[model samples]
Target chain A: MRADARDNRARIMTAADDVFGRSPSASTDDVARLAGVGIATVFRHFPTKTELLEAVLTLRLERLRERARELSGDAEPGKAFFEFFTQVVSESASKLAIAEALTAAGAVAGAEAQEAGRGMRSAFNDLLTAAQRAGAVRTDAEFPEVYALLIGASRGATAAKLDPAVRDRMLTLIYAGLKPYA
Target chain B: MRADARDNRARIMTAADDVFGRSPSASTDDVARLAGVGIATVFRHFPTKTELLEAVLTLRLERLRERARELSGDAEPGKAFFEFFTQVVSESASKLAIAEALTAAGAVAGAEAQEAGRGMRSAFNDLLTAAQRAGAVRTDAEFPEVYALLIGASRGATAAKLDPAVRDRMLTLIYAGLKPYA
Candidate 1:
């Protein structure tokens, strides 16, 4: 692809992310308008609205995976893992809404998005393992369990409509629970 | 009230619980048939199916509150609180289903049921306080935080369709997080 074409694709993805984040049912034309590109160009890039949504979801997961990769290199493994965990839970609300919107729009997660999800999980597991090896987290903490905790915390906080302070407190308690017992 | 009338009402409630548990969409006539009572009798006890659902939900919460009360009287505060927490999470799947069914059936949780829910919360708080005082739980934990944890844990487990053993392991990890760091 030409450099200009790659830029156009990236712009379309960013615009779709914004439009769908606000309204899951937004049309591809809306994304095109937001991207300041022709509808023909948007179609040229995505081919279909579902494909555009799929690309956006995949990009979101990939961004997280990239962030996790950076955090995994931090010297303080415990701090790195906990901060990544907190950040993920906090960001999950909008991401979940987007995913649900994609589902509601009849877009089955494509192979690319699913693969990105696996990449995100693997990156997270690396952080968790680092924390445990550093004696920051409980050795018994499994990836699945922590993953459920992340889902639950985000979902519960959203359902409860908790204020930031209260949600932070809850996260702190959960972090405490995940740590090795003295 | 006549003794037989009371017995018939009790029987009707039990039948409603069973029928709704199996099929949230089941008709009240089905409940009457299961109770071996006339439709008129069921109507006499609960003027509306919503009323019947309200009564059952209230009864379920009341039972948990009563159980909490009994556990509060136990000599072991930490054990009592942890056990009650686990039991509540385990049972939440069915109760939540019933609640969702009630909502789908156009039943607003009646004032009585809401009151029972508060009563249950208060009872659970007593156990939390007892556990904290006994040095089993961290003193800094607040009621709202713990409540959110309960909601998250139950909802997450259900969403994951986790097996019982896996759910228990997750619960144990949550319990560990709630405990004070030595």
Candidate 2:
């Protein structure tokens, strides 16, 4: 695409993300307005709302995948794993909302996004394995269990609608739980 | 009330609880069928589905409050708190489903259920305070934080679709996180 067209596309995606986050039932016109673009421009870029959602989800997953890859090579495995866990929990909460909206809007994740998710999980598992080997995490810990804890901590934060200090406490508690058994 | 009438009410409530648990969208007819009573009889007792849900939630919360009070007087504070935590997490998962369903069905809790819930939370906080005083739980932990952890861990377990062993592991992991610094 041309440079101006590329800029418009990026703007549309970013605006759509914000609109969806603020209101799951956002309309294309709302997204276009937020993007400072006309409805015609949005349609020119993406033919359908499902196509737009699919594009947004794909972008989010790919970003996660990229971050995981960058963190994969860090020398301090324990710090790397915990940092990644925190990042995933905080970020995934909103990303998950978008994913759910996509599904509700009848826009299933295509193969590319599914592959991105798999890649992200595998990198996360690698970090966990390294952390466990360093005796930072409990020996009995499994990657699936770790992922569950991440989701749990995030869920806890949402359920409690915790204030900042309390949210920090919850996250700290999650980190403490992952420490090697006493 | 007559003995038979009391028996029928008990039966209807029990069956309603089960029906709502397995299927949040279950109809009153479904509940009556489960209770082995006529639809007319169910309506005679509850007047409406909201009334039935209020009754069920009230009963569940009262049972939790009773258990909490019993545990409060136990000599072993650590055991009491941890056991109560386990009981709440495991049992409340199903109860939460009913609660959510009730909300989705537009049934807000009546004052009675709200009072019962307050009673339960207060008892739980007392248990936590005792445990912390015993040096079994961390000092910084708050009641809301603890509740959030319980909900989070429960959610993680469900979202992971964990097997019993992994589910057990998730609970153990949450406990590990709750301990005072090693």
Candidate 3:
């Protein structure tokens, strides 16, 4: 692609991210206006709205994977795991609207997004294994359940009238739950 | 209300519950037809989709409250609390689509629902207090945090591909977290 075309593509993606972050149902025209590009230009690069959404999610998921890799080498596995889980919760909440929109559009029906989800899950499993090996977390529980709990809590936080302090409390409880028995 | 009119209303609510249980966005006409009532009669009774949703949730919430009350009187406060929490989680998952629809339509924002939510919170608080007093749960954590964590776990269960056994294990971990320090 030409430099100018690449720039337009990047600009459209960034705008779509912003617009869909706010209103998941934002139209292609909204993305075009936000990107300061013509509708035809927007359609030229991305044939369909679903394609645009998938691209945006792909970008976000890539960033999330990068962050997970950075956290993987942290000194304390338990702390690293907790911090990574917290970050995932916060970041996932931010992108949840867009994910919902993409799912609704039937764009995420295949293994493309599934592979990304699996990558994140594997990162979490590694953290869990490290923590259990260190005797910091209980051995009885598995990774998927822990991840599911964290994800659920994140979504509840979005809906409930909770204080920031409450989130910390929730983290403490989760940490406590993960502690090994005497 | 007339006897036949009351019967029609009950039938409509039951049918709405069944359809919405399957698909939250089931059309009013579908519900009316399922109830063997004319669309005009359904409209006459409900006036709006939101009204119909509220009617269904109102019935469900009443049943939820009754269950809470029954659990409160059970032999083991801790066991009862866990059972009650599990029931809430299961119901929430099963009716999530309808709940979302009700929330979107602003039916759940009514004063009645708010009061009911507060009542449920208080009921959970009472259960937590009883369990703590019985030395079955931790005294350090607040009741609201416990409720929030359970809600979060339920939300997580909705998204994750968790097996029933894995879910049970996760709940066990949460219950362990709620226990007093050994």
Candidate 4:
């Protein structure tokens, strides 16, 4: 893609995320205006609100994957794994329904959503695997279980409107539970 | 009150709980039939199905209170507190929507539901307070926080369809996290 087109796509994605964050009912026109782009351009890129949301979810998956890649190379496996977990949990707090939303977005985004999900699983598994190898995490603690726990915790935090200190406290407690029993 | 009338009410309540447990949408006729009571009897005791459900929820709240009372008498404060948490989480796995259901049940049940909720809180707090004083729980931990955590964990367990071992695993992890950060 050309530089201007790439820039337009990035701006639209960022704007869409921001707009949608504030309200799931945000209109496409609102997204276009926030992106400083024409309505036609927004339509040309996403075609529909569901598609736009799909793209946003896809982008988030990619960002997490990138962060996991960076964390995977860290010297401190345990710390890096938990930092990544915390980041994912924090990002996922309000977006806990993203998976269901992506599913409901219809057929066009199905393959893409699964691809993003697979990418996310792969990314987190990399961090978890490394942590286990370093003997920092419980040997039997599977990525799937951790993923399930994080989903629960994120939604819990959102429902509770946790203060930052409380959020940190809860996360730390959960992380400790994830550690191998001493 | 006559013995037969009391028996009918108990039978109706037990049947209603069983019926509602399997399907929240279970009909009053079904409950009446299961209880071997006439439809008029059912209507006489509780004018609406919502009222019956409210009655069932009230019973659940009372049961929790009774359990908490029993646990409070145990010699081991930490063990009793955790035992209560585990039991509540277990019973609550599929009933996470009980509070919302009660709220939507309408005006008559509202005060009673709140009273039951308060009763549960007081009971659980007694165990929590005892545990904290014994230095078995973290000083900073509060009953409200624990309540929120259990709600999240219970829903997560339901979503995950966790087997007994895995359920125990996750619960242990969360419980460990609940322990004072050593």
Candidate 5:
């Protein structure tokens, strides 16, 4: 796609994401309105509602993947893990909406999306392993359990509109649990 | 209320709870069928769907209050708090559904329901204070944050259908975070 065309598509997707974030049942017209584009332009870019949603999800996931990559190189693995987890929870509303859309549409064939999720999981496991090795995290800490819990908590944060202070406290508690027992 | 009438009311409420657990939107007839009571009898007792739901929630909250009371006496404060938190999370679907119903109907003014919620909160606060005094839980820990996080996690668990192992692991992480650094 040409640069202008690509930019238009990106604009449309971003607008659609914002609209859908507020109202999951937003119409293509709503997206077009938000993008200051015509409905025809939206259809030209995304053939169906599902496609439009998928595009929005793809954009968000890409951002998350970039964040994971950035965290992977942090100076301290424990800090990286904590920061990444916090970031994920904070932005979970968009991610969760996308996940819900994907599940509902049964559109699990997006290899790129799958890879993005896998990359996140891989980065988490790496951080966890490093933290344990450094004696920062608990010896009995299991990667899958921790990841699942984080995901669960993140999902919860999306719905409950949890206060930032509460979230910080919860994170602190989890970190304490991960600490090596004296 | 007479003893037999009270027993019958208890039986009907228990039966309604079971039916609602199976299906929150279950019909009044279904509740009556499960309770081994006539539909008219159920109607006579509850009067409205909202009333029935409130009754069921009151029962659940009452049981939780009882559990909190029992734990407060026999267990260490930290352990009791943790156990109560876990129990709430484990049964959050029922509690949350009822809470939502009560909030929606605006029928949460009954003395019994209010007392149950207040009693549980006081019990939880007592446990928290004791744990803090013992230097087990963090001094910075606040009751509202803990409650919010637990409620948030419980909501997430319901949405995600989180497995028991994953839930326990998350709780462990949370407990770790809640513990004092020293």
Candidate 6:
């Protein structure tokens, strides 16, 4: 793709992610308007609404994967792991909405999106390993447990529509649990 | 109600709880057989499948409420609180199934069941207060947070179809988080 075309595609992705994430029923025209691109350009990049959603989901997963990779190297391993954990939980509500929309539309997550998710999980494992090794987290903690906790915590917070302050306390308690013996 | 009639009703509820919880689509006849009662007895107690489910949900909630009340007097408040929390989560999968079955049948939890739920929540709050007072949980942990955690963790475990061992570890991590700082 040409540089301008790549830029337009990136812009379209950013807008679609934000738009569809917040309002799953948002239109491709909304994406076009948000991206400051023509409808033609939006369709050129994503032939269908489902395709656009798939692309957005893939981008979101890849973004988390990249963020996890970056955080894995932080000097404060525990903080890095947990901050990433919190970020993931906080973002999960919107991400879930997007996934649900896709499902409702009878579109399963495509292969590339699943691949990105696996990549994110792999990166997430690196953060978990570092935190455990640093003696910051409980040594017995493993990826599956952590992953389940994340899913649970995110779902819990979202379902309750918990106030941000209360959610933080909830997250704090979880962090306390994740830490090494006091 | 007469003693035998009350006994029959109780028996029907127990059987329905088990049957529909395990297989949401199980027939009323299955419940009758499980209760060792005649089909007429089951229908006499619960006129419809939805009625049976609602009754079971109320019974389940009341059972939890009673359990919480009993555990509140335990010598070890923390142990009681965490144990109840674990029990609720463990049973939530089945309870949720019943609830979903009710929803699928286009029946909402009846007012009595809703009352039982509130009563259970109140009892749960007492347990939380006792645990916090006993220094079993953090001082700042409020009912909403605990409730949200319970919800999140339960949904998470169920969604992942986590192995029993992994679910325990996840619960352990959550328990650790809820503990008062060392």
- Top model number, TM-score: 3
The Cα local distance difference test for each model comes to 0.79, 0.74, 0.72, 0.75, 0.70, 0.80
Higher-DockQ candidate of 3 and 6: 3
True contacts kept of 2: 0.74
Put down candidate 2 lDDT per residue, B1-182, tens digits, no spaces: 89999999999999988887666578999999989999999999999998897788778778878998999988988889989877766654544453342222222567887777778778889999999998899998888778767667766554455566666777788888888887
Which digits, one per residue and each the tens of the lDDT, describe model 4 over residues B1-182?
69999999999999988888667887999999999999999999999987888888888777878888989998999999999888866654555444333223234456776587677778889998999888888877766567657655665555455665666777877887777766
Clashing pairs in 2: A177-B177
1 or 6, which is superior by DockQ? 6
- Between candidates 1 and 4, the one scoring higher on TM-score is 1
TM-score of every candidate: 0.74, 0.83, 0.86, 0.74, 0.77, 0.76
Write model 3 residue lDDT over B1-182, tens digit each, in one string: 99999999999999998888777778999999899999998998899987887777666666666777777887898888888777766655665643353233233455565555556667777777887888888898896578668666665555453566666776777778888889
Find the 10 residues in a row with the least total lDDT in model 2 chain A: A98-107
**Which candidate would rank higher by lDDT, 4 or 6?**
6
Cα misplacement distance, residue A21 of candidate 2 (Å): 2.3
- Which stretches in model 4 have alpha-carbon errors above 4 Å? A1-12, A22-50, A94-109, B1-59, B95-111, B180-182
Q: With candidate 3 superimposed using the best TM-score fit, by how many Å does residue A129's alpha carbon deviate from the native?
A: 2.1
Q: In candidate 3, what are the lDDT values of residues A53-74, reduced to their tens digit?
A: 7777766656666777777787
**Maximum-lDDT candidate:** 6
Better of 1 and 4 by DockQ: 1
- lDDT for A35 in candidate 4 is 99
TM-score of 2: 0.83
- Evaluation by DockQ, superior candidate among 5 and 6: 6
Model 6 Cα displacement at A175 (Å)? 0.5
Cα lDDT for residue B146, model 4? 70
**Candidate 5 pairs with clashing backbones:** A172-B177, A173-B177, A173-B178, A174-B177, A176-B176, A177-B176, A177-B177
- Which rank order by DockQ, best down to worst? 3, 2, 6, 1, 5, 4
Each prediction's Cα RMSD?
Answer: 5.3, 3.9, 3.2, 5.1, 4.5, 5.2
lDDT of 1 at A125: 95
Q: Rank the candidates by lDDT, best first.
A: 6, 1, 4, 2, 3, 5
Candidate 5 lDDT tens digits, A39-92: 998899999997887766666666766777787777787787777777777666
